[model samples]
Target: MHGLLSAYSPLSKVIRKKGIPYLCSPMPPSTRTPYTGSSRKLVLAFDVGTTYSGISYSILDPGQVPEIKGVTRFPAQEKVGGSSKIPTVIYYDKAGKVRAVGAEALRESLRDTIEDEGWVKAEWFKLHMRPKAITSSNPMDKIPPLPAGKSVVDLFGDFIRYLYSCAKLYITESHANGTQLWSSVERTIDFVLTHPNGWEGGQQQQMRKAAIQAGLVPDTIEGHARIRFVTEGEASLHFCIQSGLTTEALKSGGGVMIVDAGGGTIDLSAYGEGPTKGTFEEIASPQCHLQGSVYVTIRARTFLENYLRESKFVEDVEAMTEYFDKSAKLTFDSNPLFIKFGGARDRDPKLRIRGGQLTLSGTEVAAFFEPSVSCIIRAIKMQCMAAKKPISSLFLVGGFSASEYLFSKLKEELAPLGPNVCRPDSHLNKAVADGAVSFYLDHVVAMRVSRFLYGTKCKVNYDRKRADHVLRFAGVFNDVDGIPCLAGSFDVILPKDVQVSETQEFRKHYIQKAFDRIGLEAATSLIYCYRGALEKPLWWNGSSDFSALCTIKADTSKISRCLKPRLTTWGQTYYEMFFDIVLSFGLTELTAQIAWLEDGVEKRSPAKIVYDVDA
Candidate 1:
């Protein structure tokens, strides 16, 4: 009796509407300083998730404080004025052309259009970019597949293009002189894209490629430079700070934990205030898990299939599950959930179906949420154990946080952990979209923990006294100076779980030997990341723990001009080039450069990061 009787609920109450109100309250005045940039510009943040997406923007005027705003209006939303978020869904016709997108695809009137036009639906497409290391609790086969003849990047291009157009329309219509304001900053606009914490450079490369394809930026170096990446966990922390959710904790000198429970992945991150006021640093390595709200829906679907196997209405399981997802899943409290899917003609009393309604016990519904709940609890404990400082408060924010059941469950289980657990009362789903903008404007996070060991493979001088060196001596070779060396040695520049500052640089020096100057014309250093549990990785050969993370391409032609030929003890002449592979990891993204000395002065050249497309 406490359950709703309709699948198509009011759009405002829909859990997928992870959007802000038409007019968001301005950020607190003291949260940030006035803009100091030389010229006016715009920053647009896109929070593209598996089930829903949103856009937030800030116009930076020199010497004036900036405010973050959301694109409240979107095409096909039920409301006439605006919505906080739009469904991450699209429809493609037989020709592979986009027929409808976002909230438009969910319109009831589009049913006939889809049926007559043979349109294919694509939802939860973002999960396709998930890293191979993170496995989902639910079966991948249950998730919808991409449209025919379309790759994951293609899907991203189409969706990002739609979000861009929506932002344009909303900005122009919502503000004073909106057209003029947009035109002034059109070319120099900066974009920040948020992704899960588990995503690596490979996923970032795919996203950047999609941005170029979507026409958000040109296919040039400068255009690509305008794009930035941030983890959903870090972004949420910024949002929590700006929204004044963490003020009390910060005042008491206690660290905070941010749990971003979204559609596809839940990201966990812990932070402590920096040495300087108004700044923060990561106290623990961030974690991302594939268990999220969508998994609960998947589990529900599987349960329905088996529970109704012997019933005559088994063919209607899909419709029933859809109803349960859109309503019962979000409104579930400690009561029975009644999913209304059909008319009064549908009656199966033996299976607890009457008056077109299907009733499910609260315990059965809780089982669907058990996997996600357990994953979060385990991750939180691990983070607490790994944190350098004690955590005193936990902030829950994201689309999935709307579930009252999930919120109560987390608070109850975490009571004994000594951290206060709570979530924002409103606009919780748009935390990432708004927080992404805050991350760009206010440099709150100063230090971050490295998630893995990053370094380069090099050769080590052979020492017969060492057991490791003796075992690999068979592959030893004589260097230019006739010194015996063994390959496959790992030079760790940065170890896992170490705190690093934003300005910190990790440099690894190496000397390359070539027979001629032409061999030193160009240099390509392949950077590798170790995923194994070894405290100190010494070798990479014959081990599956190592993988190519990225390649840093540098022009060593300048070094060739400074080097001269040197004769080995065996009377062989060779050129020796000295250089250093410099890497920066504290920022949201990784950057690298090559450095060497020219005439007693250090010269540095920017290195291009290239990731394997298949990775």
Candidate 2:
């Protein structure tokens, strides 16, 4: 009879019938509609940068492509006698009004004409907000400062707001196809803000909050006016991908390294395909350090400062801040002082420096930046090694990516690695913003094609002695043929990564028992172990013993039933199950089944039988 009972047990019964479970979640809302012919308008894509920004507009006509207008440093209006490249400065007047920002602010400093009473300074201001301080091997110390009292956060907000204002003005003043067209329909402007991917979560959050505060969106914008964020390297990749470059060939899974040498930070990331077919992935997470164009610029400025001092050309560096600021704009010119002092070479031949009887060519200017460029290349090479993949190609982007000398140096350094090293077209700086927009569109569209699953169930089992020892309690069970059985073993359902969008379903499964009325006190627990090692438990420390079955709760009900799981998204793969458990009561023993899915089908099997008794 015992043999027969064992043969007919619930566990045996389940073993005889193997099956799996199928789960589903609610579908995402639709975002597409019939394309009725409407007046062709433009969608603005703005890339807001530390020292410069660019805007590109795409016409919505059925076959029209996006067009990039002028990319310039802020303060669109030319200074009375100043060079370009927004100075990254802001100042206030005696009347407490913002007197200047960008290039004008830099001019005031260079000329030593800035008023003391209402002035504020901000040089390399963006670098200050990052987790690490910007440093260089050169002797360029003492960055320009913002107002003494205003926080860096506030200054950033103000600067972004100023950019939006400038953008609005530019759109209004510019001609549409050279016809000086204007429109009554307020054009929807979408912003893409780029940041170093290595930023801490808190810093990313702060940037988002600041963007919202700066009116990037209208609490809610009409139509698709939105502000999105993308990492700088990823953005540059997008720019390269769109530039009719070799991106398509590279996408077949070959490893590629991206180096984003920007104004305030150098960001690096790797992408590659696995040995198997179609298993492309971002090989290494992005890394960032506070070193970029500003480092070289500062070094060049220092060299010039010392050169001027020794030559008796300038008495005080501080007194000549405005002049230096203007001279910095000479970046577009050949033989600018920055180049003469060891900056990157200029491509423009017309920009020659006039000395008493000496003329400096681009080569002389390029010599100044050779050392700095070498430093940058070395950093890139180090980062490539850290990625651990044999790089098949190297892509450079950002403001400094355009430096011909820097590009040449990169080729030389990476030559042994292979010949695929290249720079994205001039528009690489806008890549991040463009990528953000593309990502958004892809995500929204993909949701329409795939359904997500949320909450599900799984079962747990343990030896009777082990269970009793772990729980410090006893329980009994009945044999399959109805004979009384000793308290020897136990089984329970443990929640894994169940993709419940909300907490309600999580609670219901844990609390809803067929025969038990365990109070909430019996449900709290310390550790909720899944299938593997219990190194990182979900609960807080000292809450309850591991033996005490804790109730697992999802934060929202929507996730429990409405969220469709996607294979590509991390949120779906991380969670396995979605229920909680508690101590049982009322019987000498209990035997039952816990339902869980195996493949696509649901199955129930004898999980465990717990004996009710005092340990």
Candidate 3:
């Protein structure tokens, strides 16, 4: 499953419902924070891949092109022309204090383990953030336990803080070594974090929370980064369309399916080129799956461990890991290939390797790659077959997208289906980050397919005029003529896969039912966003794909509405208050507003989105 739909969602807490920054949205601010001095502007993009992460940027100017820098400067690591990708590793002490991050963490933790120390490496900790539920029996239980007292969110925050600090320094300090060379003066950095497209509001919300906690946003300190998000697929699409990289069919307004195969998730979205360059119309709702390159590595590691059981090679984890990192994960061949790790004295006559390297055969490696690769192939095939229009192109992008073996496998299977498959000639691995910068320049997708059925739960009146026994006895939140009227009934605001524009809005009026002594507060709105491909999920009970995200609350106390006891048409006396709930859609996040209208004047009251943390 695509592991992102957080915000009172049923997925993991790492990603939950995304709340758009009220300050940045076009909507009037309910409350305003004091402004500090403005700083210089720069656009930064971060691709925080599960296996590895990267950073890229462009100036805020319209004429500039984005650049992906080689980020090789971590504490205690020498610059080897800097690498575009950094291992997403973090090391913490016995007390759960973070010690190192990225390449440094990977390099030091192995050293410490060899010497038997307190430093424990949380390798692939990103897996803990999966948006899907898992039991103790799941393989995720095998991921290295984080040190005592630190939650996954805490660690991810620390990692982001470290990365953000480093990136800020690098952007400001580096010069003359192929760096973009910005002024040393303090500058406002705008970030576009890329994630799998299939993720929902909750996942995005968690990212925003992490960023703020990481001090990348407002955290007591006068931070310069203004953060936002773009999905990995969207960023890749931006680069593809702008660089003239899509197949001819896609370039000329034909359909293209983007498969962003990254280290953690494979995100899919189908689109047709728009009349305008770099613009597209979504053909279907995006899809995401946990199948990614890390699965291949995991399979390979398990195979090696079992194959070398109790051997000296197995005992020396460092050597084995180095071999896997350098050799096993890179090669892809039909003819057998060998991964040789042991020294001359420990040589095995494995024909797959040349010049006496301890090795694993190509057959073993293929097995490792098959699970993820096969799943991806099936997904692409399904997407193409199900497309409303013929998919005339397939543009593969992401770190895994750069793999020769993956490319070859995709071509062999997908080429026969008749759409041209292509990739960027350069910067293949950094497209997501670079494209995120492009997305900041302008949104490329004209519209999006709604991934969920979003709406509210309101009370519906029972029909006394045509009362049935079922209606008379049914459970209800309110009653009329002694007939039960349900209040938990779902109301669809936006149906799934329907077009949503940057300027589109969903506004509805609801009445605040009587509570204790004349209500002093304005009415608050609760929005329920349900998953599933239902075009009309209006009446869906608590059957499936349903979750009550945190309530969208607006302070109506300022509007001065005196709750008057009034008689209803059904001869019921009640104190009723009326207010409106509004949701404005943006390219990535939704801006919400709750208002009280009086005498043709609208009061923009303070609004807050309370997330469903327990869900």
Best by TM-score: 1
Q: Count the backbone clashes (under 3 Å) in each candidate.
A: 3, 50, 19
Query: lDDT tens digits, residues 376-438, model 2?
Result: 677667656655456677777777666555666676677886636666433545555554443
| lDDT for each residue of candidate 1 in 441-478, tens digit (9 for 90 to 100) | 87688899999898888888999999999998789998
Residue runs of model 2 more than 4 Å from their true location after superposition: 1-45, 59-76, 79-87, 94-96, 103-113, 116-118, 132-142, 175-189, 218-225, 248-253, 273-280, 301-375, 386-389, 424-615
**lDDT of model number 2:** 0.44
What TM-score does candidate 2 get on C-alpha atoms? 0.55
lDDT ranking, best first: 1, 3, 2
In order of appearance, the predictions have TM-scores of 0.94, 0.55, 0.82
Q: Relative to the true structure, how large is the alpha-carbon lDDT of every model? A: 0.85, 0.44, 0.64
Better of 1 and 3 by lDDT: 1
Scored against the true structure, residue 423 in model 1 reaches a CA lDDT of 72
